[model samples]
Target: MADIDFGDAPAWVAVVLAGGAFVISLLARRDSKKSAGAAVEAVTEARRASDAGVRSAVAAEESLALQRQEAAARQATEAEAARPRASLALHWQGGQIFHLVNEGTAPAENLQLLTVSDDAEPLEPFTRLGVGEVAEFLIMTSLASGAPTALEFAWDGQEDPVRLRVPRSG
Candidate 1:
């Protein structure tokens, strides 16, 4: 074997080297834990930002949907409140009350009924009735609020009248 020179290193050199190695290992472990913590925090922050964006987008869509519904409801109310002139009548019999008939060559379809001034209303619901089908409406004595209860039944291009009393129980 070739001779190995110690280069003035003493027997204690092994202990010094072991001590240095232990100190270096502790420092490396601490640095690694810090780096891992930083990585986790970064991921958490990114997730929170993504969630916030999604929530904002959902809120905007909901607001728009509500606005659309409100506009549609307002438009329907205006149309129903202002129709052309037509009226119907109220007839009573037994405990069962029904409507008078409104028929013509060009009568309307499922009538859009409304309260007339006190002397007119349609009194039937006709299916696909062309030019002479009858329309019916009900007027119970108990359901009348206006002094003179009147009804107006209107359809595609036709209108009629009937006077109905207010219903009481039903």
Candidate 2:
């Protein structure tokens, strides 16, 4: 290369200045690339944290829904267990024939027969009697032989036995 003459400085000074500017530009570009990479990493970390939070919220909502369903099922079971049940009713068939009827929704368990009459023995106990079922008993002594009397019996869900009075036969 040929050296060019400047007004007061040597041509080598201009070459050195150009080299220094090139190096400065290269360093600035490298710093800019580093800054861009750091910004991208920060954005990626923020997005990951947001996604984790959203997943946690969704899981919490699902758990709450399951708990609500369990509570509803429990309430339904309790209501079913508390359904209305009716007591037994006594009906007259004839002079010496009398029958008991269960007029309830649920079955009666452990029925005991108690008779106040002196001539007949107590009837056998029943284990289970379904709804609208009729159980008959034929008393050997006629109803015309004795005055009006009452019979007491106990069953499931009843703490005290109820008295059923026998009417006078015609």
Give me the candidate number with maximum lDDT.
2
| Whole-model lDDT per candidate | 0.57, 0.80
Cα lDDT tens digits, model 2, 59-87, are 99999999999999999999977886646
| Candidate 2 local distance difference test against the native | 0.80
| Candidate 2 Cα RMSD after full superposition onto the native fold (Å) | 8.0
**Ten-residue stretch with the least lDDT total in model 2:** 1-10
Query: Candidate 1, overall lDDT?
Result: 0.57
lDDT of 1 by residue, 31-143 (tens): 99999999999999999999998998999999999999999999998876664323333444335445444434334456555544445563444455444333343444445
RMSD (Cα, Å) for all candidates, in order, is: 12.7, 8.0
